[model samples]
Target: VQMLWIPFWAAGIVNGVGHYWGYRNFEAQDASTNLSPWGVIIGGEELHNNHHTYPTSAKFSVKPYEFDIGWAYISLMQKVGWATVKKMPPKLQLGAVKPVADEKTLEALIANRYEVMAAYARGVRQACKEEIAALQARHADVSVLTAAKRWLHRDTEKVPAVVLPQLAQVRAAHPSLDKMVAMREELRQLWLNTTQSREQLTADLQAWCRRAEESGVAALREFSLRLRSAQA
Candidate 1:
């Protein structure tokens, strides 16, 4: 809501007081009328009945010499390229227009809007799944490091040759244990950044299962078992 006020306090006071004392300008059977020659300064004061009679007129002042303050502001805004006024079409201007949309049309519009939104949501979910896959791959490499540490602590001299190459690969992939730890932190932050609601998460999980098949299920179950074992 925007409001424009005239500079003069007397104008404002007259606007408030003139409504009851003014002479009727139209035969609308209403008690409203015009107050003064400078009707613009007081924003068409006491002209309710005249407005009811000719609501479509851009100018509220019925008389040629009457001034309209609201029109002055509208002119200023137009000069500054800040406003554009579009007059209503002829039928609507005459108050003869029917409703643009019926119940079924409105329902179809709403359904289409939801369908577009659902497609956008599905795209976001797919992007998140790709990011999660990258995180899981990083987690796998970190798990290898963790396994290497366990083996190292058990007996560093007795470490197997087959596992030695795998340990070296893990070490080469992640220069330090701290790098793997940082990757884990980054993965957690990425998960936190998701805008997915509970319903969206459920949908994403179901989609992921469909895309990844048996490998996805086995990997998730193995990770779950490892987490429980670690907790124990």
Candidate 2:
């Protein structure tokens, strides 16, 4: 009964609290998160976000601070000739490249696109918060600013239609905030352009970098430069 109950209970909580609680390493479309970095209990299934981030990987731990006891057990089992590791996540290799993105850049982008978006989203959220705080200080307009911050990272459909006006208002009021939000969308759309040819994509990326730099948004320009140099 322990065997029956334990796995079922673990699965339920992992699917529940794992989605509702803890810090998300990646801003996944779904609200999946790591229950804990030290995944020793429940056979290391606590690292659910890492599992979702690299679904094919048998080892769930991704960071230096993380530990997957299940992976350790699998290694021990392999050493005793009772198990075998099958798959792992591919490494994201970003290297220097020409001004235009190449095949290697596309490959690397495809492999780690989610990670790229996650980082962009986090940066935008931080910038948004700082902007909102400044707005609240200057105008004592906590309600609108607070709502803007709240829905900043949510899925577009999840945000109330009424909040759209407030977002536009905030954007009009803050140049830096607007630039961060627009840059995030541009980065997302760049990857979504499947119809574009390789040459077109490379050209688009180069154009994006130029616009980003000219916009005078420090974070956006820095990220664009990083993207320009990225390769697989």
lDDT of each: 0.41, 0.74
Give candidate 1 misplaced runs (Cα > 4 Å): 1-19, 46-48, 88-232
Candidate No. with top lDDT: 2
lDDT of 1 by residue, 1-232 (tens): 1145533533555435544556544333243456665664456543544454455655565556766666667668978998775641111111222122223322232223222222323333343344345658766434554455433211224457778765565546533332332222332232344575544443443333233233333333332222222210
Best by TM-score: 2
- How would you encode candidate 2's per-residue C-alpha lDDT over 61-152 as one tens digit per residue? 87789999888988899999999889876666667745766666766766788767666676667777777677667886667767787566
In model 1, state the lDDT of residue 160. 71
| Candidate 2 ranges beyond 4 A from true positions | 1-6, 78-83, 132-147, 153-155, 158-166
TM-score per candidate, in order? 0.28, 0.79
Candidate 1 collision pairs: 33-46, 40-68, 40-69
